[model samples]
Target chain A: MQLPFSLQPLFDFLGQFTDGPANALIIVIALIKIALIVGGLLQIIPFIILFERKIISWVQDRPGPNRAGPWGLLHGILDGVKLFFKEEITPKGVDKPLYLLAPGLTVAPAFLALCLVPVGPIIQGAHLDALVSFLRLDPSIIGPGGIISEIPLAITNPNIGILYVLAVTSIGVYGITLAGWSSNNKWSLLGGIRASAQMVSYEITLSLSIIGVVLLAGSLNLYNIIDSQAGGFWHWNVMAQPVAFLLFIIAMFAETNRLPFDLAEAEPELTGGFHTEYSSMRFALFFLGEYINMVIVSAMCVTLFLGGYHGLFPLPWEAIATWITNISPSFAGFYPWVIMASYLIGPMVIVPAKVGFFIFLFIFARATLPRLRYDQLMDLGWKRLLPIGLINLVITSGIIAIDLMVTGNGQVELATKWIIGAITLGLFLAWDLLYYSPRRKAQLEKDYRLYPKSAKKGEKPALAS
Target chain B: MLVDFLKGSALALKHMGNFIIGKGNVTLEYPEVKREQPAFFRGRHRLQRYRDGLERCVGCSLCAAVCPSEAIYLEAAENTDENQVSAGERYAEIYQIHLLRCIFCGFCEEACPENAIVMGASYELAMNKRTDFIAEKDDMLDPAEKGFGDYHEYDPYISHVTPESDKSAKGDPWAVKAEH
Candidate 1:
């Protein structure tokens, strides 16, 4: 086994201090990486909350939060301060330890799951080129350079990245369950039970949906998955496995307890559900956890389906680097930053922008769709999405098998993708139409009856208020 | 059925897209942009004056008689040589409208024989004290001079509705003749 790429430099620097093992240096580097990722996430969550509000308001045609500061950007900050100072209240009878532990449990998994998701590309080769060409640093001074080549804008890359995310997210249910159960309130208990059941049911569909992507990428590591989709928009999993994309999006919404599938915290029914007994910072943690989870899920969707860090157009990095170098003698040193930015920071911006679109969709869907009844939610997860997901997995695996057996050429693979994508789209459209036909007809007739234009003179329309 | 669902979603998407692109917002920023009140809007009452600066009220007590809320109070006095207040023999020595009891029904405006008590557009009648609700003669009376600092821009919609009314109120005989 080799030392991870990011820890090699640390080990090299610490080598002179003592003739000691590199394990301590590696651990420190790991700790620092973890701190950076967590700090960035904590800073980002409030803005995401603010963005959700702003998008929701814009969709509904109102200027939202422009009063707090420029475009109401500081409203979230003000809100966080307000939540912090609010009186912390624990109701008459509650299980003390579990109630306290629940919010932390909910928050921890979300933060941990973000570790494996790469936000930017590894820029080792280019950085090496830049170092050799621009900086004129001694090659030997940057020790073990070839060994520590992978430079990713993420905390760490585990071999089982996808599995880790699924496993960690599953554990998040316990937090909700404990929060509801420990509250000693019937509503909270009901919310907990609903959340646990819903999450469990959706987890199957969620895992099964990703089976298609995994099969296509042939890797569980998120960085590898994104690397596999680096060519163009067409190479994204969304095109290759359209069925899986649809299933993942639906299941992701259910997993996160977003609206339409948000049975657990259905404000009308559960009165804030599991977190009803929480107050101040505890309540704030749960809220923060929810938004961070949203960011993580959005990032995952971008990584999996939209081709994470892949530019929409093929990036001409060498040209951009040359342009920067020609700008002036002073900018020669900055060419490396420019080159790294084109490949690394460019995607850093693109990935977030794509994730933001999904976030907007989440908010838009909340505004557009009504909540599903409890039975409908269960039936959709168990009966509809599960079967559909299983069928999609089988189809995807079948395609992969065929590709391996027949002419294993790139052209054949492209043709296969197009064929499978078309078939899946047709099937989905047919299923959706058949499922919603009766309701559509009923809705139309209901509308006609309510506002009948052919009402006789002196006769009133139904017009029930 | 699938087509229907798609259609519904498309319609919603179109509406939202229009709004995002800066369309369909009819919301007025209330504090900044006030709405144009209608000509018939009976807000706080005001006593009118001729352009030549003569009070229109004859102190006939018609508005006091017709006020359903009993919000009006007046005291009649003989017009003196040095302080001739009205265009008639008698003038209101003390006229007050207790806005607290006033129903804003415009009956008082309709009952004024001299067309003196017309409701102006100043609807911000809030007061810190109970006594402040009572508008004395000074508060109700129109400005003595035209283009007074206290005057507001009149609504074009109201002016369009009653073009002759403004001219006659301003004592513009030429405009009244042109209208006739």
Candidate 2:
């Protein structure tokens, strides 16, 4: 298979080691990488859940779940343990196999999609060569014979990365639908149907919204996408396609079935939704799947719109890496690794910071917004976001076309100014349409004044007028 | 339409921001930080002692009779030369306050003829066993170091006790207030 332009060097470096019996070592490393990603995600979801509760409580001006551990850090962990010990109850006349398969189906794709999420720098073939030469490790051992663990930050960097994410996440719907249908309970069926319908409706907008960034990045590979956003903040897709960023975030909430978009598991209407009949570890799996999905979506958002790992200023990693190399001849083998670490630390920190910002947004939205009625959810997804996504795509493409035309004549300076002007204009127009308008202020005041009795509770009737 | 949505979002953002940046959290981590109880707050009842290390209860059973919840129980016994538990002619041989039934209304304290019992500031009355809720006379009695003067420093009924009978009772602040 053909590798992406950026990854060709790494492939060539690894190619020398992929001889006969040595190939099995690659498999070992691959398995380890997958394990690390899955294990890290499993450990992280509990904390994310805890943070969600803590953030929501803070927003509501309350201290949430402080008793379980220091600042309630162990609350989610204890809840998971409690869920594990709970009796596994399968109600009468359930499709047992499908019911069992539902949770695995839901959770598998959440982890699968994360393989494409780049958390740090991809170590190139040059770095691999440097490490191999300095360490003076056996060529047979280094190649693919013994310890060939030059692991990239991500598990895999498939060419169809974004498409892979889109496909896996959409498949997650089947799990919910199956769980709901097999439960044979009316509420579970309702929740399942609502979930599938909501996911299906929003998936279109979700994918289409992402297309705006895909066009701007000019690539499907997640690494390439982040690479294009390098240099500075303005170069980021968020600054380029701010409309699409907003659209994608809204659609992401629906896709994840988070609050305000969580019509499927609406506790008041459906006791526990699709997992109503599920108990013990089976029920816990669904919870884990939901939180992991949140992490994936937040990571995706960081990669696509927020410049993944790119900090505000240009990081002097190369100079620092060289300085480390010069200082230690004895540790020359480790210098490349040190360089890789220094280079990766920016992205490793910044990307999580970006993901954390979105996660906070998710929790904040949950704390603030009421769940949209099912019909309202559908209307917003189909009638509102779908059209907005298409429009954003067109706008992004038009800007890209103008950019291509202007840059072809070697007048780069003028083209940049034009793009900046256009972005600012678009942002201003969006701000006006969405937030600040005299018409909206007048309407708000009119609504307030219309409710004279309520208004008079805090003010005189004469003053209310 | 979008403007209204954004306006609502702004309101939510403002609320969240104010909560994060402003000191709006009213949550008190209980068991860590306790709230100050008011002066008239009725809580666990304690038996008082006079300055001479004598029990104040005369075994009149008025507190037990007045207890709306019937939480108090006592047995009267003669105070002799060999053993005198109180300044009065009789003493309570067995005094018990059942905390489970105690209403914490201070009525027992109000009905005490000798001002033997007064509601204390200790409100943590949690007990694991049903039997633990029954506080005995010894558990409820104030130690000898705490005298009737310390207990009735502000007692309203202390003035009613004759000055010739109990010296500490006449110097009550409420007694001065009652005269005014």
Q: Which residue pairs come into collision in candidate 1?
A: A433-B2
- lDDT of every predicted structure (CA atoms): 0.76, 0.76
For candidate 2, give the docking quality class from DockQ. acceptable
What TM-score, over all chains together, does every model reach? 0.74, 0.76
Per-residue lDDT of candidate 1, residues A272-327 (tens digit): 99998899999998888777777788888888888987878677777877887888
Candidate that scores best on TM-score: 2
lDDT of 2: 0.76
Chain B TM-score of candidate number 2: 0.73
Q: Candidate 1 regions off by >4 Å?
A: A1-54, A62-65, A71-74, A81-105, A123-149, A173-193, A265-284, A313-339, A402-419, A434-465, B20-22, B42-119, B123-141, B146-180
RMSD of each: 7.1, 7.4
> B56-103, model 2: which lDDT tens digit per residue?
888999999998899899999999999988888998999999999998
